[model samples]
Target chain A: MKTDWKFILQIFLSFLKIGPATFGGGYAMIPMIEREVVDKKKWIRNKDVTEIFAIAESVPGAIAINSATFIGYRLAGVRGAVAAMVGVLLPTFIIVVILSMLFLIVKDNPHIESAFIAIRATIVALIVYAAYKIGMTAVYDKTTLGIATVTTAILFFLHVHPVVVIISGIFTGMVAVQIKSWFGMSIKLEKDELNVVKKEKQVKEA
Target chain B: MDVLVELFLTFLMIGFVSFGGGYAMIPVIEIEVSNHGWMTTQEFTDVIAIAGMSPGPIATNSAIFVGYKTAELPGAIVSALAMVIPSLLIILIIATFFFRFNENKFVKSAFYGLRPIITGLIVYAAIKFAITNNVIGELSWHTASLMIIFGLSLFSLIKLRLHPLFVIALSGFVGMVLY
Candidate 1:
């Protein structure tokens, strides 16, 4: 695909707006990204949008950047990737640079301190809201709830590292699936087993 | 050996270690910034606010903020790139290979399990941020009062589809007036 500079410019501006204005993190950017990219610009289809999101989450990078890179690469290949990355990052770079300068000048200023006090309180509320939104989707069943509750308890009480909990959760989930299969409750597992056995029989006959 | 290399490597390590995104990166960033005498605890809090107000992931914002503080425009570019590189490499690799195993049962189960764990980590992050910012704190009359406000605001924000920015602004107003 030929890289379109005009399209790249539009994307850059959109991301600049999103970067400066978005309150939370990656998840919070979704609605805005959808509004700008899918609904307004028609840069990608709905399924493509969903796939980008899934890819962003499963991968190890910042979700926003990954999504941008995917969408950019899809639209215009390497140049698009570069454009999107630069677009999303530019606003933050500018804002942070300015703030860093101002902070040095006012390191001991009383009003700046008060302003931060107020902002921090507000940020706390925003983070709580983000948690609630994610929880609604994630904690749907008893087993999932149990994992969340236990993970939270360990984090709060034991000061356990979150990565440890994440690893354990994956293990527990695998065990849960195994148990479900053992009890003949997993149709997917049964089907997989049946396919494997059929393949084994075919090989033996040949 | 140079200050720029030190700054770049610091951000690279921060990006590499931080999982579950922005909130998860806080402690690591704090350690790095403090260790290098780049920023103080209170100053770090301010940087977080700036990052929160801005966009493109908190870690990147912090890197930009910290880098610019240490050096200048060059510092900002280096730090931001360093923070992003690790994640970008991982994402690109995963994107290449993820589709081949899209329907694998174990992979599906693993992701399914990861959902709840990620949720828990996110929730814990919120609570920890609240506590660290002194939004909620050790039990006291003031703490209890703020907790009530917090709960009500949280409920309203969730149930009513209120714009979070507005809610955050309102809470800021309340803090300004009361605290």
Candidate 2:
């Protein structure tokens, strides 16, 4: 595939333009990306956008960045992937760095300190809310509930590394499913179900 | 140079297991941040506030903030790249060979196990953060006000569905007024 500089530049600029709205990140950035990449640029079809999102969500890392790289790769291979990745990253990178600088400068101010006190409280709430949201989807069955409970217990009492816990989760999931199958039981991943529900809603809306 | 390498490697490790979105990565990031003695839990919460208010994924945003706090611009760049590099490589590999990686039964089972654990980790992250921030213990008017702020924040987020940025800004103003 002969990748033109102009095409790469277009990929970069399109993502860069979508970069600032990525404040909450993940799925929040999807509509905008779809607008720019599929609806506007016509670089890919609407159906391909759905496939990109499916893969992007399943993979590790931010969905926004993952989809960007996927879209770029589909269009122009490795170089296009790099172009899209850099493009999406650059705006937020600059903003965050500048914020870091500004934060360091005024952090010592008493008023700012007081404000941060409240902000910290809100941050905790945000995390709690995050857990609630994930829990709704992640903790559906008895086995899942057990996994979540044990994970918390291990974190609190055992003092193991979180990565260890995550790796354990992976292996545990695999083994658990295998055992369940031996008993002729089936496990349903809620995310797939969620996708189905979403598609149903989309169809209804259409 | 050694610090930069450590920063890169730390975030690279984080990037690999950072499933279930940026929030789920909080506990892992918190552990590394404290292990490196980069910041205190209180300070980490402040960093979270910054990351939450910023315009990107909290995982990468905090990585940039933590890296910058530790080793300046180079650190920020290295950490950011490290965080995303795994995503880039994994994505490319899947895009190339296993377009149906999501449909692989083994992969599906792995995620089946991973999902609840991700939820568990986030719950733990919340409790740990609250403990470190003194939200879980101690008693004072300060604590009382903080609780009120937290309650309101959670309400606004869940019930009202206000954007987090707006909630943060609102809480900051209330903090200034109260404190």
Candidate 3:
């Protein structure tokens, strides 16, 4: 592929367009990214989308920015990666910075503090809602449900590292798989209807 | 300068541990931010509310908010970079050698366990915040309004299929009106 500033700019602008719509997390933007890069711009093939998405998930940042960087690197090397990352995150960066400033100013006011009091309670509901959203996919079978229950109990009571809970969750999955196969149990772990590629398994894991 | 560096380092560590995604990072974030005295647990929940309402991954949004609260725009930039730089480096390295990394069983197994634990973690955060933030202590008429807002928020999110950002915005409006 030809490497040029214009091409990098195209990549950057394309991702900038995708960034704002990526609410709820980065993975939701995969189809949009795929359309822009593969169908529209022809920067990479359909297959590379899945590959980049997985690499994005396995890495440490927002999958949206990471995947944008991967596609950018594929096109124009390090400079392209930087451009795409900046483009993808720029909208969010601007919004959050502005909100932070506003929050600092308003948070101390009596009216706003009173509002936050209500917002705080509602936020608890939202957090529970998050757990409900994740639970639908995570609890596939009785075994997995047990794991979630135990993990919740241990986390609530012990206050140990979440890293341990995660590691143990994997071990529980492996053990459950082993038991099912060994005993010929018909139970199978079906993930949420979401495709693995766009989903966190390949997309949203932060 | 020191605050920016500390913010950078803290979020950098958080970035790696956030494999299960945004909500999964809340507990770890609570630990770090509270331990540093950067924010109280209740204030940390406020950050979550802001991050939830904003666009982007919650972790990244949290990084920006934490950065700004600690030291302004420069702090925001450094912490955001720290939160994401690890992903950039790791992905760049992988782009060179591994084409099909998720095929590994160990990684798969770890994620399998990770999913439920991630759910558990978020749930735990909810309960903890509920208690610490005084969601249930006094049970006054004021608390009733809070519970009503909670019901609406949950229903909008879980059943009505409202966008989270929209629900948050609406809740804020309602809070202003009622409280």
Candidate 4:
């Protein structure tokens, strides 16, 4: 419970070590983070990992960084949070900046241009796959399916800003839930989320 | 100097609304990049490709790249900080006061709408990327090859369960050979 430079640096170093491993996406890094914070360091309990991650996912920003900040804040304070955030950001920042610099230098090469051309195509596919994966969890019921459809249509046709869409989504959810409750219908938020979390826990345990 | 501030403020705004994590953040970033004239859509696609191949969240990685592209190292640092600052501050505020914040009923209801919209946002990002990259447009040898690459990449991702890094590497090789 002592908030000192050493403790803050400890948080920073711990997350700095975990930073590079966040390669693919935030969800995949969950177990690795749990291993470090829960099992090895004992900074938090095994039980709390899921809750922290859930909150992290629900909030803004990358889940990896968010959860790291949460754990660090839980351990120390604002300084710990900043340390852990910078810790997580530092490795990826350097790697990306290096990659960017290299990219800038070689981007005009014919071979490199060809490679990136194909890579761009592949990136589109990756984004589509991400949407499919999210859609499976997000578009469960009729209402959700409708929301997803309408949202896409709105984006495509209206050309509205994404932030507006998001704020609208929140109000739409709240209002829809209220209306559904009035009509004696039950609504579930993120139905698959719990199941997925449970499956991840089971996999981790196994 | 102005660009650094612009980079910071832009990413900071992005950080605030970045629910549902990195993929959801893409469409917003794409819009901002184009609006700011920081890079061409083609260049932005390359950034996404590199970010995907890199070892971090795509959103954060892309922010660093965009920042660097715009105003060099200082821009990169400022942008990365802006992206995460929202998370740090929001988590700190919630953790201190609202212990069971996720379980709050209105928050639950809000996510009900937000979740599907995030899905929509990601879907839009894919469509937008495909359009900008000429993936969805007319059929040429180049477009055809790109489509082929896209199909194989998606198949490998969903069915083969290949890591994205591997998939990307293979696609780049295919690109090198084909192009």
Give DockQ per model, in order: 0.47, 0.85, 0.65, 0.85
* Candidate lDDT values, in order: 0.68, 0.88, 0.79, 0.87
- Steric clash pairs (candidate 2): none
Task: Give me candidate 4's interface root-mean-square deviation.
Answer: 0.9
Return the interface RMSD of the candidates, in order shown, one decimal each: 3.7, 0.9, 2.2, 0.9
Over B1-179, each residue of candidate 1 has an lDDT whose tens digit, in order, gives 78799999988877765545576566457657877888875567667766765655877887788888778888888999998777666655555564633245776676566666767776776676677766677888766656666676677677877765566556656655665
What does DockQ come to for candidate 4?
Answer: 0.85
Q: Residue B159 in model 2: shift from native, Å?
A: 0.6
- Model 4 accuracy (lDDT, Cα): 0.87
B1-179 per-residue lDDT for model 3 (tens digits): 48878998888887766675677788888888888899899899899889887878788998899889988999899988888787777777777775566656655555666777788888888888888767766888876777778888889888898987788777777878876
Q: Which pairs clash inside model 3? A: A169-B113, A170-B113, A200-A204, A206-B21
Better model by TM-score, 3 or 4?
4
Best by DockQ: 4
Highest lDDT scorer: 2
Off by over 4 Å in 3: A1-5, A167-206
List candidate 1 stretches off by more than 4 Å. Answer: A1-24, A27-46, A103-107, A167-172, A183-206, B1-21, B24-45, B66-75, B95-104, B135-145
Query: Can you write out model 1's per-residue Cα lDDT over A101-172, one digit (the tens) per residue?
Result: 776787566655555566665566666665665566566777778888777778888977555666676677
- Superposed by TM-score, candidate 2 places the C-alpha of residue A182 at a distance from the truth, in angstroms, of 0.4
lDDT of 4 by residue, A1-206 (tens): 55589888888998889878777976666777788999899989988888888788788988888888898888888888888888877888899999999999999999998888889989999999999887888889999989998898999999999999998999999999999999999777667534455567878679
Fnat, 2 decimals, each candidate: 0.51, 0.83, 0.71, 0.87
